[model samples]
Target: MTFTSHARVDTDRPARYLKQLCSHFDRKANSTFDEEKGRTDFEFGVCEFLVEQGALVLDLTAGDLDQLDKLEFVVGDHLERFGKKDGLAVNWKRD
Candidate 1:
């Protein structure tokens, strides 16, 4: 079975964060993104991003619970670092 998690990160600049994240991860993973949406394939799992008006939605999928948890932390931590000035937060719900 696959493990999954979702997070809606509130930020004033969703598009900017989305692009920033995709670009950063592209250096180490397979990432493709534009202004509205993006996807990244990491060694641990897959993360898909959607930029809304004032938030960035993240969907993460992995083969197991450990991978899912790792994916969530990695993505969320990077985003938090990137948006520290804006005080961004990523609260995830598992599925």
Candidate 2:
């Protein structure tokens, strides 16, 4: 009934990356980000992302298993772009 994913980024200043991501959705999606707390929360379709732990921890949830695939792709793509300079490796998987 529900699908969830988790990703931990091994990089310096992970919070900055998460903040960058949350900013991207500030205008379009219903979202909220707290850079100080290193947390970002966003709602996209049937999916939701909860990024915390200085951006090192990423939690994604969707209404259904199928929806999670697209959600994961979207999140991963954005993260890849943000971490491109540092070549940060983010390994996220269904959990």
Candidate whose TM-score is highest: 1
**CA RMSD, predictions in order:** 0.6, 3.0
- lDDT per residue (tens digit) for residues 1-95 in model 2: 67788887776676687677777866666566575433334453333434455446777778776667777777788888878888876677877
Residue pairs of candidate 2 with colliding backbone atoms: none
Structure candidate 1, residue pairs in collision: none
* lDDT (Cα atoms) of all candidates against the true structure: 0.95, 0.66
- Report RMSD for candidate 2: 3.0
Tell me the tens digit of each residue's lDDT in model 1 across 1-95.
Answer: 89999999888899999999999999999999988999999999999999998899999999999899899999999999999999998899997
Clashes of each: 0, 0
Residue 69 lDDT in candidate 1: 86
Candidate 1 lDDT at 54 equals 87
